[model samples]
Target: MNHLKFLLAIWKANLQSVMEYRVSFLTQVVGMMLNNFIYFAIWIVFFDRFKDVRGWGINDMYVTFGVLASAFGLVSLLFGNAFTLGDIINNGRLDYYLSLPRPVLLHAVSSRMISSGMGDFTYGFLSYAVSGPFTWDGLLRFVLAILLAAVVFAAFLILVNSLAFWMGIVSSFANLMLNAMITFGIYPITLFDNYAKLILFTVIPAALMGAVPAEYIRSASWQILAQLLLGAAILLGLAVTVFRSGLKRYESGSAIQVEV
Candidate 1:
C-alpha cells in the first residue's frame, strides 16, 4: 500500500509537469510514431523482394518486432526520464532527491513520461493485432513476453545509467548502447552466425527479447519459459546490484537557483 501510494504520487507529479507543455508532448508523440512507422515500412520492402528470410515469414518478423518494440515502449513511457539520472548525479542536483523520504532512484527515474514512447506503443500494438495468429494461448504468451521484455529492457538501461558513477557523463555512451540494442538486438537472433548467436542468446541475451519469446509462443515449451524467466531475473539482479554499488560513490553538486 505504501509503495502504491508512492508510485501514484510520482505519476501525478509527472502528469502535472507534462500538462505544462501539452503542445510539445503531442508533437513528440506523433513524431515518435512516425519514426517507428518508417521501420515497419522498411520491413515491407525487404520482404517484398524475398518472400521469406531465414525460416520466418514477414508476418512472423512483424510479430517479433512488434512485441519487442511494444515492450520497450512501455518501459520508455513510464521511466524514460531515468536516462537523466546520470545528469542529476553529475550536476549535484541529486541533493533534493536525497533529502526526500523515498528511494532516490525510483523517484528520479519515474519523474517524467516519454511522450514519444506512446508512438512505439501504438505501432507495436497495431502490429500484434493485424498479424493475427491470435489464440487465447498465444495472447497469454505474448503478454508474458512483453512483461519479461520490459523487465530486461529496464534492467539494461539501469545498468547503463549506473555507469554514470564512474564516467560522470555518459549520455553519448548511453545513446550508443540504445542504438546498438535497436539496430542489432531488436532483430531476430537466428540471423547471426553461430558465435554471434551464442553471444546474443547468452552473454547479452538480446535475442531472447523477441526471438526466444516468439519461439516459446509458437512451440509452447516449458524450457523456453523457464529460460526467459531466469534471464529476466538475472538481468534485474545485476542491474540493481550495480546501481546500488554505484550510488555509494555519488557526490551531490551545488543546486543553482534559476529565475523563471
Candidate 2:
C-alpha cells in the first residue's frame, strides 16, 4: 500500500513536470499520433489491394494496432526509463537508485515520462472506437488486455536490459531486439509459420504483447485472457527475479566521472 502511494507520488510529479511544458508536450503528443496513423496507413493500403489474409481482416488489423500502440504508449508514458535502463545500468547511474530507500527497479523505471506517449495512448481508443466491435464486455476486455500486454512489454524490456549488468553498453543489441518486437507486432501473426510464431511468443514475446491482447479484445475468449494473464505473471516474475539476482553482480562503471 505504501509502495503504491510512493509510485502515485512519483507519477504525479512526473505528470506535473511534463504539464509545465504545455506547448512542447502537445506537439510531441500530436506528432506521435500522426506517426502512428501514418505507419498504420501501410496496412490500410495493403488491405485495400490484397484484402483479408487468412482469417485476418482490416478490422483485426485495427484492433491489433490499437492494443500494440496502447501497450507501447503506456510503457513509454509511465516507465520511460525502461528504454534507457540498459544504458543507465551500464553507465553506473544505478548508483542514484541504490542510494534511495525505494524499490530500485520500480523507482528507476518510473522516474521518466515520454509526453508523446499520451498521443499513442489516446489514438489507441480512437482506433478501437472505429473498429466496430465496441461493447461493454469488449471494452472491459480491451482494458484488461492493455494492462497485460503492457506488463509483458515492460517485462521483456527488463529481461533484455538486465543483461547490461554483465555486458557493458549493449544498446545496439537491445535496440535491435526492441525493433524486432515492434516491427513484427504490428502484423498479423497468421503470416508467420509455426517456428516464427514460437519465436514471437517466447524469445521476443511480440505475440503476447500484441497479437494475444488483440485477439482477446476481438473474441473475449476466457482462454486467451487466461493465457495473457499467465504469460504476464510468469514473465514479470522471471524479470524481477533476474534483475534482483543480477544486482548482486552489479559493479560501478570503471570509467571515472568528474563533477562540473
Off by over 4 Å in 1: 257-260
Candidate 1: lDDT over CA atoms? Answer: 0.76
Candidate 2 lDDT for residue 174: 90
Instruction: After superposing candidate 2 on the true structure, give the runs of residues whose Cα lies further than 4 Å from its correct spot.
Output: 253-260
Candidate 2 local lDDT, 3-97, one digit each (tens): 89998998899999999999999999999999999988998999999999898999999898999898899999999889889998888888888
- Per-residue alpha-carbon lDDT of candidate 1 for residues 149-177, written as tens digits (9 for 90 to 100): 87877878788878889898988888777
CA lDDT, candidate 1, residue 47? 81
Best by TM-score: 2
Error of 2 at 202 (Å): 0.5
The per-candidate count of clashes, in order, stands at 1, 0
